[model samples]
Target chain A: MRALFLSLAATTILAGIAQAEPAIMPLDRATILAGSPFDFKIELDQVHAAADVAVTVNGQPYASVFGKPAEFVAEEKGKDGKVLGSALIARGLSIAKPGDYTVAVTAGTETKSVTWTVYGTPAVPTAKNVIFLLGDGLSVAHRTAARIMSKGMHDGKADGRLAMDDLDHMAFIGTSSTHSIATDSANTMSAYMTGHKSRVNALGVYADRTPSSLDDPKVETIAEALRRTTKKSVGIVSTAEIEDATPAAVVSHTRKRADKAEIVGMIYDVKPEVVLGGGSAYFLKSGIPGSKRKDDKDYISLFRDAGYTVATTATELKAADGSNSGKILGLFHTGNMDTKLDRSFLKTGTVDKFPDQPGLVDMTQTALDQLSKNPDGFFLMVEGASIDKMSHPMDWDRAVIETIEFDQAVGVAKDFARTHPDTLIVVAGDHTHGVSLIGTIDDDKPGTEMRDKVGVYDDAGYPNYTDADHDGYPDKIDVSRRLAIFSSNFPDYYETFRPKMDGPFEPAVKTETGDYVANEAYKDVPGAVLRVGNLPKSADTAVHAVDDVVLQATGPGSDEFKGYMEQSDVYRVLADAFALGAAQK
Target chain B: MPFALRRRQFLAALPALASLPRMARAEAPELTFDQLYGGYSALGLTFSDKVKLLDGQSVRIRGFMAPPLKAEAQFFVLTRVPMALCPFCSTDADWPDNIVVVYLEHRQTFVQPNRTIEVTGRLEHGSWVDPDTGFVSQLRLRDASFGLV
Candidate 1:
């Protein structure tokens, strides 16, 4: 398989080198959903007259195949009015047939040809609801640690299983984006939401050469598809800001995910029935103290006028669940919500300011209760956002504890699935972080040095954590013996083998030279040692790993996810489960 | 005399010089980062009474200097913690809520980022946008000068 992939990559590069043809959107061998709307575009290498250019599909004129005429521009100007090339665009085009389509474009001697495989699903649906739970940047080590920490371990094995461990079907998902092997949360989740792979930092659109983020080729997002073909309600829940990349991918189209202000307008455009998370900062006017917007448009008031109940805290969210309008918009924090370790266990990390933030479990339950009110069923997406946020800073304790909290949310979804067997629950991660638990760190076995206290293979024993209060979290994070996890890549930082009892860790900071350096705040800790970074000086923290993410699923239509699949392929299974191709109207 | 002893003797003579009634006295109030905000909510933050009272008055604050937005600029950001991202370089980097923008009184070389520095200036509180750079800040310190603490 490795050899085949490398050779195919080599052949594609050689073909591109051999031809000076126009670049096209949806590159060769693309698998498109039948009858799904997409923007078709072709970029010619040189300016050409509309009469001189010819486009064909399957030996027929493109106009005859798509039943529409393409808009042609003799010269496409780039940034600062520089002439890039000539272009042709056809918007809102869909192919209704299930077959291989060969699209060829020619202008004088410049020519390019690509093929797409259009697939159709069964006419009948296999599931009534689809719940996708994504733990951003989740990795195997996080799962292992969450299981060991929450469920406890004995005699090197038999503790118990996590909510995700017992899924009936599992697969290894390749999460590489279109442009590179490495991936971020934006494109990775975008591919899952829209069955098309895109470049990094892009969501629901192909990365184009244009400077304008909005002009990129657009694709139909899952939420838009549900609105188009079904009567089902849609809900988006996350611990991060709702306008963040993961949740925004459900109904957004921009080449850049950082276009967050624009993303708020996109969310308003769709106006899903339930939207819960942090990020009220973008909804406020500029005069408001916590407002992050440069404009004066108040989205909170806009949504309220649109008949949506807005909740700002846990108590308000619970109250708004009884809203007669059946639409709830909960903004718990101005930024990312505080984690469970801060809100429940430690009572640190901005908990004083926002004391009543809800946990992911409670938010998920609220979403389920409201979304299920619709008789036609619903499509819900929940995200455990801080699992990735804390991992980037190499805060292993916080990251692992966040994983535990995420698993508890998964348990809630599983409980709902048990009652509604027709519901499909898909649990996966957008990408993987390079983190792993090596062994135990036993304070009892140590001299003065913390490094000497690290217990390796034979000396490693089970961690001593208690759940005396019956809460899922360990009673205390400052255990005498604890798991030692580390990231493969990290910025310059001081390695302290203990939990940050104050707040989330800030391992590195930027210097005046624009390079990252180890923060000296932790330098005074008794056994802390400075570890030179393995990453570049420009990187502020650890980066995402290129390894494949593990995807697990249960309920109806899960058997289809059995082998290796691309991140985009996961969407095909989802569409098939709901029969999104058939017109329910 | 040793450099330390010489510096100590010079500092020791400052009180005697202050005894002269003709010299002006500095009355800069001290403030901490925790005292800047009274409450936080999703709607917005409320300024503490101390911050409102010290507005337009000379005050001293201690913090670490965040990386400046431009190589040659009139101001820098002072944060309770060292910043993780260069806001000028990364489009996605966000400033913390409690940052204090310090407009320098004169051109000075930037110091190492690992040490804490004390800044003295007139405190200004409001939502202000810098005209030249278009940088936005809720709190600011005007004509600020700093020294290593």
Candidate 2:
């Protein structure tokens, strides 16, 4: 019997050798919400007439199962105007049943098949609201450093705990992209928001072969799912541009996260109750002095006309909190907001230019205050963006401070959860940096070189960071002995074993040959040393790590997140908590 | 004899006196990155009085030359500090607000980003888009010539 079956499979393979298998969107083994809408697409290796192409779902006609016919293109053109292949596309397709579906396509001698699991939530919701707090590039090192810096360590024990440290349930999340082991903020956050894994730099969609960023195969974002099945308000808050990857993943569906200008339009389309962060340049008209848009669209006025209270400063943000409109759009900087170290302490970086920019805590609180007004509950995402931004430059001091700020924001969410016990709060990182907090750097160590001052094991003493004012941040970062952190990978750079007092670190600069070289600015420092890069010369800074991110949650349905899970699986817990599959409205 | 000698001296001095105005014209006023903007806000940026006064006039500024779009391109961006991230190389990076597009008088070899350069050119301000690369700039220097400072 086994020999006969092998022979049958060999005959089937031999009969279809004329062409390669076609490509299918949502790939294989995708888990989708039962009622969530998504795009269905297939790309054939060879062009086939509509008559020759056949599609079926569970051995039935595709149109009958899908309740609609897919549009067929005889020839799909590539970027260079060359005919690549034939294609079939169906937008906004959804399944209402909970089961396994096998979709098969056959065109001439080429065949491809994919299976998807359609899942459904309980008829009743488990959580009234959800607060997702994401610290971009938040790794174990950042958490350890923030704890040691904010709360002093004594006898090898933490004197205090971070707000995220008290979460009831936790999971180790795999953050790899669909195409590679390494990932970026866009792909990881998109996976959590859309329940679908995508390529790097992609959000709410599968990266297709097409050159157009907007035409990718779409997946429904959490914001859209709420808009479809419930009357819940959605809020997005971040220190980076609101149109940035993590926030944009909440409502955008672009193949490229760098499509910021287009992302603004997408955010406007969803019209979240509260949108706060930087990147106002993309919202302004091209005629505006600081505008980055190439088109004439003015999203600031568009959002204002949509009944949003626009605030440009922290003072205005506070005043706008009392706005009867219920919608707030706070844009404090023309670009990314300054780091917490620059905003509240050092007064470096762009702090002089955008001095009144609010921190992540303020934005998160404002979003909560406004969003909680909804009777149907709400979904608010607060991001500590500069944690990742500073991590990229290998500026450990600033990144740790940013993590502290993110933890404070988590505290605010915990405070909200106290009054609204039905609210579920999730604290996670989209991805991680290749950073580690090894030991301490003692200025008093007897050494001619900075590397000699590094302490490890027994010699690694505690950092002298103090929270004199008890604000959960060290009063001074440039202590005599400080936490010694390092990245596993970096470009050629001068390693200055001290805090960057002047501003954020700019370790490397590009040369004429498109290679990165150590910046000579730090060469004059007392004990600076040039460290040859472990990465390629093309890398300007340290890259993201492929390590799994830690996700913690509290409140109803939090038990779903335990042990090990995929980043995309986190969305399932969120959906089940909200009963997104069952229409609540 | 003394009168003839004095007249010869005056004749020689006439050439030097005639060149004084030309020398004054060649001495362009200098500008700094801090002086380019008077006010900055989320709404927009305002050109400083000095920047407004130097418009259409020859000016000199000191800044780091960013990598050009192309190896032999005629223009490049001038930044107040050496750019740690290449916006041209990575789509996620963006140019700072204080960048000035420099259109060189003649294409010159790009310099290392860490080295500051003194550029002399006619100052221009207002929103203008480069037709070749579609790069939009609010401030620019035309016919620029630069040398390491």
Candidate 3:
């Protein structure tokens, strides 16, 4: 027995030795924009003396290639004085050459190697302006539903096509993050804003084993790169909070997307010329009634002091548009703005509180008008964020209506692109949802139960929705016959076939046992049925699906966005389009 | 004293206080969710005159209890509607603008989140950060007791 115990101890020691290899940042096969700045870090498995550690780039000393020496820490400490390991940090390092560069790190007996491609673009730019439109959690069903609901459908064909449908180029974008097969808005949009695929919840940085969300190895965002290389302006517009993941990815560099207050400071650091969205709560001091911050810093007054005209309503946004200040900060709601279905016709949700909030179309047009004042160029990111927000709750009508609103916003961009031929418009989604439009639900069917009214295959006739106002949205979405959309995954929910006219759907509620149960509030709906959840009991709502997002682009640089490509590769095409490698100014 | 011990001592005296309250008590005014907000804007929300008049007075309100912050926590958030997400458990979750914090008079097991409960307590207003939890609440109910309607 003593001999067996000694052998077991020896086996454990050997396993530990086999796993002790150094970790290098700018992970293997990383694609970096040439001349763009990034941080290089090496975390050794064990504490090592400064003299014993060596790092080399392409067979040359690290300082010779990066033009600066790294700061070495003999032992990194944790909260309880726990020795984590030895680490080396090099900030703001760049490579001007366009080729694969291998980095090798050696710390005593431990060694690790990683290869990165430093890519450069042509000297001349192909596009003067770029408009990137992301419909958050957009899936094929949303486009199909939006087209059917907004444009209407005849016997077999759509009455008209969406503005996004007419784009010149298309690609299937793989949106998996570095750490998981599934992706979130932060990592997916961060990949577009920075030429790196990070783990979930991370933006413009690689997820490290640090406890602090802000101490991760950093990557330069597109907004930062544009500022570094050009004299153009930047504009961010979204229906969700301005500091939400999709918009925040353009300027933030944190390991957690929930660092919204810090993200506000990051946005201030970049200072996008025109910023419009619904995160006013974070900008207020903590003592204020509607404030969501934990600090006393008031960002609204700060932005005003910096010459940004603050607008809180649609009328105020239009009024600001007339001014020559050339900068606008619009916070229409304290949180995410009400969806179009609520803001336009229903007058529900938080619309009664924020009565005059601008829709995505109005915000996009205002951003374009203000951004065009710059003769050099501008990069504007317009996000239809509520498509995901409503989807999580299984609110199909609201999500489809938001998609219609998003398409109308696309029409506004396309109209601008028509006149300004040099503008490049790229429309895509950060990720997809587990939603699909199978057929139609007709109230005319002979049945007391709503599920019996669902018509599939040939019985699934086109919906009857009228758009007499010509506002590009259905006059009313709660028509007798409507599109049937369902999520593939959901918690215990009441599947009411009819549209939720009273307000947005709340399909599930948490129980005392910390498990989600079907919300009994909707139990009395005409034909509501309790559908047992397929997801884990811990899930409160439907989750995002791991699917390829469809991307479409138009104008000069659009040809590069073809074939199946990783989400990070799309950023390379954007960099090449504006020739961001070499300074344009 | 330890919080658990202090709480037990408070609970021990609750029955005597309740017997005295039955002798001379006026019916508490009931407040609604809509009555809490006088005006709303992107800048801030104003408390209604009704809410101001009833400050520190016994009031009854009906709302759904959100999932408790912890099994042993002494407070829970009261929301106008059933909360689908627990803000404390989910990293990305955030509370709606008009949640009311309820500090219980005594420790009690959490009730079903979907059921509406009527809570009676002294209405407290203004920004107050909890000393133990550091939670910021604009409106609160002190010494609250709740029962399902």
Candidate 4:
């Protein structure tokens, strides 16, 4: 019996040893853009002397192929003060040629190999400017609902079209991260901004197994690439904080997106010509009342000293537009700006405090106006961020209204594209949500319970949302007959089956024991029922779906965005559009 | 002679007892969350005149308590609304702009987040960093005590 136990333990130990192979960055099947710089790294399972480690590219010594020797670390320590492994890191490595290159590593008893495809673009540029508009967590259901609510559907399909509906070129983008099928805004946008697929919550860098959030394998962001190769202007506009994940992906390099204070420094490092959004909190000194920074750095004064025209309100933004400085930094709120529903109609949120926050359209138009002054052209990215922010809380009314506002920004881009035919317009979502527009909820046909009022199949008749002013948005969200939008997953919460009129919905709240329980504030609402959660208690609200995001584009070089492609592949198209490989400088 | 002496001692204690009611009537000045700030802008927020006047004085404010950083903590954040997201649990979540950090005089048991509480402490304004936790707060209540309202 003792011998049998000994053999069992031996089997387990052998399995552990077999699994401890060396890990490689720029993981297998990675696509690299020629001349774009990236950090190369290798993490070995065990410590080894410098002479014991062997690395080669395409059967040649790695140092000869990369044109430099990598820094060797004897041991890498983890957060718990344990020695993880030995590592080799080569920073700012680039391959100027385009071909299939295989990297093989061997140390002691472990061996690992990865192949990368390096591709190059044509010598001449296809587009002089690129306008990338992203709607966070945009899905087919959002587009359908936005069209139905804003354009008015009849009999089946008798409505106007969204600005995105007219884009001639289209693609289905797979948004999975390198580490998991699920994704977040940071890595997904980073995949578009940098031609590399990184782990979730990471931006412009691969998520290396390290304790430090900043010491990951860095990839060159699009902003840095433009700075490296061209004299074009760059602009980033969003409804979220300027340091939020989506906009921060434009120039940031970190393994964690929550490093807002550090991300502000990165934004300062890149210094995109036009940056308009919220999140002035990080830019302020720690002594300020609304500041979120933990240090004494005041970025507002720094930007002003750098010749930027700082604007804090819409009136100031308008006045700054008339300035000849050609550099504008507009901060509309301390945190994320108020959604359109609150800012324009409801006036329920923090809008009472931040009354003059600019909308997405206003920021996009201002960005274009400023960026166009550069005769060399520009690259502008506009994001409608609240679509995902409100969707997580299951606030369907605010999410759809944000979509309409996003579409108006798309219209602004399309108008710019009409005159500047050399501009390429790409509209996409970083990821998707499981929410869908099933049918309608009719108060007139309602019974006692709210679920009984739900109309599905043929019983789902048209809603009675009216746009009296001919504006895109419906006049009232609390109509008797309204659209029924529901998420596929949620935490334990009360389903009211009505538009949240007071403010954004708070589905669940954390208890003292760290479990999420249904908020009792909505329990007294008539016909509200407690629905058991399908998601884990750890989830506060709905989560991002793993489904593919639909991408639409038009203008020159947009034809390259057809068919199904990986999220990282989208950057290659952008790179190809600008001829970044040819080095215009 | 003993009864006469006891009567005189009781008369002396009556003056000390009479000031108790007057002390109770002079409660700390009540401050609301809405009155904490004078103006809000992207640049920063300005302290209201009332806040400036009440600085370094005992004041009471009613607000919801955010979940503490730990089970037993020396301090907790007081927010105008019950926080839906746990900034400690999720890296992406952030605290609201109107939060006030409360440093307790003694460790007290936390209550439900949805329950409102009135905290009485010396209202202090200006940025101060906690030595132990390194938490930076623009406004704080020092040596505070709270009870559910």
Candidate 5:
């Protein structure tokens, strides 16, 4: 035992400080934009004297390229005595050229090297206006089901058209993150907005070893680049809280997306010319009745002081336009805005409190009107956020209605693009969900069981939904025959045959063991059945799918988005269109 | 004469000691979760009349324990419904403002979320940032203990 202990101690010591070396900032295969600033840091495996370490870019010394010496720390402390070696940190560094740059570091046998493609765009701009519309977690089934539901299908061929069907360009975007295949909105949208693929929950920054949420190495956001490189205005509109992941991705850098208070501060720091959405909780001071902030920062007053015309209602939004207000800060609800079912039909959720919330179509049109006034043009991003929100609850009817609403918002953008031919309208989803419409659930079928009532193959008859208003949305959600939408991944949940009219479905509830189980609330629904979950019991809701989301675009720079591309490549098109890398002499 | 004086002093002390049992640790007024907030509005939630009346007093509330941020969390959130999703499940999920944090007096086994129980502790209100998690909550129950009812 003593002899074995001696060998074990030797082995433990070797592995102790011998874990994988810390990854440097602007990591391997990083594509840095020309003229844009980034933080540079090199972490070593073990402590080294300043004279012992050497870093070279393409066989040239690091100081020769950056023109500034890096500050070195001998020994850096990690979480609980996990000794990360010596480190060098340099803030706000840039390489303004279009070429392959190789970076190599040598710190006594612990050698690591990385390559970067610092690329620039053409000298001239490709588009004047950019309308980027993202449907959160949009899957192929939603589009196919929406086409069939909204427009009739006969002999495998029927339908007037969908708003996105006519787009001239298409791309299969790979939405994987730098860290994992499964990603959240922060990384995915950050890839789109910043031309960088960061780790999950990180936006516009490399996830670093630093404990400070704000101290991570940063990348320039598209909004910031546009502000720095051009005179164009910027706008952001989302159904989620303004500080939520996708909207916050326009301008934010944090290791965690839950830093909502800090995200609010970041938004104020950039101060996008026009901002509108829910989540007033962070804008109010801590003492305010509904404030979610712990700080005394009153963003509501701050935005007003910064020349924004704040509107709390749809009526006020309309009035603000007539009030000659060029910049509008619309806060329609405190949290995420109410879905269409609650806002128009059920009168539940938070609709009773925020009665005058504007629909996406109206919001899009109003935003276009305000943005068109900018002579230098504008870049507007409008998000249909709730498609994913309602889908998580397993509320199919509500989710489909929201899809229709989102499509209508697309229609609004298309209409504006028609008038403004110089505008580039790119409509796509940030990610795909596991949801699909397999068949119709016919109530008239002679069966007590819900699954027995499902119509398959040729027997799947057309659903009789009346569009008496001719406004596109069905008059009622509880028709005799309707689409049976199902998710590929979910926790233990009761499968109720009918739409949940009470509100969004709480599919799973936490048990004493900290594991999620089928919510007993729906146990009494007429044909409800408890479906044992295939996912881990810890999963409380349905998860996102790895399937590819369809992307379509039209206008000047849209021609570049062809075939398959990574989500990060979408940013390159955006940057090239705006000429973020063009020399601004 | 000295012995008689000492006897009189001892007799007076007996009455003072008798009143101590009645005067110490008096029972506090009861306040419920519904009574902690007056109104729910988009602008902000207002603390209830009962909350103002019983501020800094001992109060008791009955609710289910929502799943904690981590398995070893010292404080568990008391909620009206078993949170469908753990607020700490992901950065995406956030706790509702109505949540009451229960810092137990001693470690206790976490009960099923569907179960209801009563918590008694000193009522504390105002924004307090959790140093460990950076979770900012406006209302909390400090030095609390609870049991299944």
Candidate 6:
């Protein structure tokens, strides 16, 4: 029987050989849902006539299956005045059944073959009203610190609980990009939102070799899919500019995340029902005092023209709520919103100029009120962007407060979910950072030097922050005892064992030689110590960590998240929830 | 060097004070970030009278150093507040329009964000692309120098 089976397989391999070039879309070994639309392409290393290159799909001519002719482009440009190769491209194709698709393509001497696994979703829907929250780069250290600071630690146990402590489902998400083990916000969130691994800084498309960012072969995004299949409203809210990596991933498709002005246009193109966050600067016209655009593409007016209620202040945001405007475009700050530290306490950053900005909790509430109106439910993404922003500077206090603010937003989501059981809440971090809070810095138990105040292990004691008003945040950050947080990686910096009462911390400064050195402003702060850096001199702040990020969720599909999973898998669950692949007339 | 919000608020709120001509009152309506532009949009921005009238003349601006482009360059960007996370430092970094480029009279070392410095230079307006770096600046201070307050 074995000999007979071997003979049959050998015959099959022999019959598979053809004068054709192998074509792959939902490219080789891709796990596609029964009917997810993806572009199919095949490349020939050398310039070959279209008739000379033969293609077959599942042992038949590609024409017999796809029923369309593929456009052929020969002698694609190479750098330095030469042609790279020839290729074939076909957009908007999909296989409707669950099975292995073996694609074979052959040119004279060169040959290529690939396979893709097309899968189907369960017949029943799993979750509704998905609320996906991304804490840009939340890590274990940040979680531990938030628990200790907000809930307090007793002996070895946390005295209370974080908003995520009781989440019924959890997962350790691997955020590595398609090209490298390390990742950034764009590709990581792109994976979560599109179920396709992309190169760093690239979103909703493969990182093709071509120089043009928009010319890359594209994949359908969840935002596009949701729009195509459901009447459900989509909302994106973040402390970072809505055009920033994480939020933009929800609806953008560019190889570069820095194309914010274009991303704003893309967001306008999609017109997510409710949009709130900073980066009003990107929305403003080119000649406007605060606009960051190079052209006269006034997005605020465009959104308004499209019937979005525009608001620039917390008071205005609430007013827009009463507007029954149906769509809201809230531009809180001209840039990234100030972290909670600067927003509530220091009154630094852009908070002074853009005062009356709403907190994450407020933004979430406004979004829920507006989105819940539709009977079909909604999809919203909230980001505590400053968690990653402040953590990069090793400003743990600010990051923690931002996390607490994020938790408050989560609390609001959870409360909404309780009242509306149909809602699914997913709280996660896009990546992690290399920061930790080991113990405490006690000025009361210190010598003249700064390091002497560091109390690790047994010597570490409770922090002496005062929250007289009972708000989650401590009353004053400059307490005698405080969290001894530090970043594992850094550029040259001064370690000042105290809160930057004036503003957020500035750890490093550049020297005349153009290398980062410890910023000297804090050098005279009593016991400030200069600590040499470990990262490259070009690094102005600490960087994101490659470690797995912890994710927690609740609702029907939330159970699919367990142990460890790739960021891309998150999208599959989402597709199943919205029945994105279910045939639509 | 205390941060006086009241002073900044006073200067930013009342533009009527700006009517105090240089020849009349000892002080002028102190133009601020709030006064530089009145609206936000995608097409373009409108320059406040303070910035428009002060154009081509010497004026003072405060901001922190954007981590410099290089050590030998004669210019660097001066942004509102510290460039806590400088986007221009990286090739992928985005610049805010509110930025005021300072072309120094002489080369000087870049300072960290924590230090707030006062700069004095000729305020020039309109979009002008830099020949050296191709950096487009709508507002610039030619022949400028700064002092740590």
Clash count in backbone of candidate 6: 27
The alpha-carbon lDDT assigned to residue A419 of candidate 6 equals 89
Clashing pairs in 4: none
Which RMSD does model 4 reach against the true structure?
6.6
Off by over 4 Å in 6: A1-27, A42-46, A78-82, A510-514, A583-585, B1-50, B59-76, B80-86, B89-92, B103-121, B126-134, B143-149
**Model 2: how far residue A296 lies from native, Å:** 1.3
Mark the 10 consecutive residues where model 6 chain A has the least summed lDDT.
Answer: A18-27
Report the candidate with higher TM-score, 2 versus 5.
2
* Residue B43 in candidate 3, Cα distance off native in Å: 1.0
Q: Tens-digit lDDT track for model 1 on A141-210?
A: 9999988888799987937788899988999999999989999988999999999899888999888776
Question: What DockQ does model 5 achieve?
Answer: 0.35
Q: Which should have the higher lDDT, number 1 or number 2?
A: 2
User: Which predicted model would earn the best TM-score?
Assistant: 4
Clash count per candidate: 0, 0, 0, 0, 6, 27
Query: Which candidate would rank higher by lDDT, 1 or 3?
Result: 3
Task: Write the number of the candidate with greater TM-score, choosing between 3 and 4.
Answer: 4
Q: How far off is model 1, as Cα RMSD?
A: 4.8
* lDDT of all predictions: 0.88, 0.92, 0.91, 0.92, 0.82, 0.79
What TM-score between 0 and 1 does chain B of candidate 2 receive? 0.82
Fnat for candidate 6 (0 to 1): 0.24
10 residues in a row with least lDDT, candidate 3 chain A: A16-25
lDDT of 3 by residue, A239-331 (tens): 999999999999999999999899999999999999999989899889888888889999999999999999999999999999999989999
Question: For residue A318, what is the lDDT in candidate 3?
Answer: 95
Proportion of the native interface contacts kept in model 4: 0.77
Per-residue lDDT tens digits for candidate 5, residues B6-117, read 6566445444322333322235565666676776555677888787777677777887788777877878888866678777766788776678877766566666666677
Q: Across residues B1-149, which tens digit of lDDT does each residue of candidate 6 receive? A: 45687556544543433333444222323345566665443234567778888887777777776767666666888877555445655534567658888898655555555677766677888776678776667788887666555
lDDT (10s digit) by residue, model 2, range A1-585: 999999999999888774567999888989999989999999988889999999999999999999999999889989998887999999999999999999999999889999999999999999999999999999999999999999889899999999999999999999999899999999999999999999999999998887899999999999999999999999999999889999999999999889999999999999999999999999999978899999999999999999999999999999999887899999999999999999889999989888899999999999999999999999999999999999999999999999999999999999999999999999999999999999999999998888889999989979888787899999899998999999999999999998998999999999878899999999998899999999999999999999999999999999999999999999999999999999988
The residue-by-residue lDDT of candidate 1 on B78-136, one tens digit each, is: 98877876667765556667889999766655756887877788899988888888777
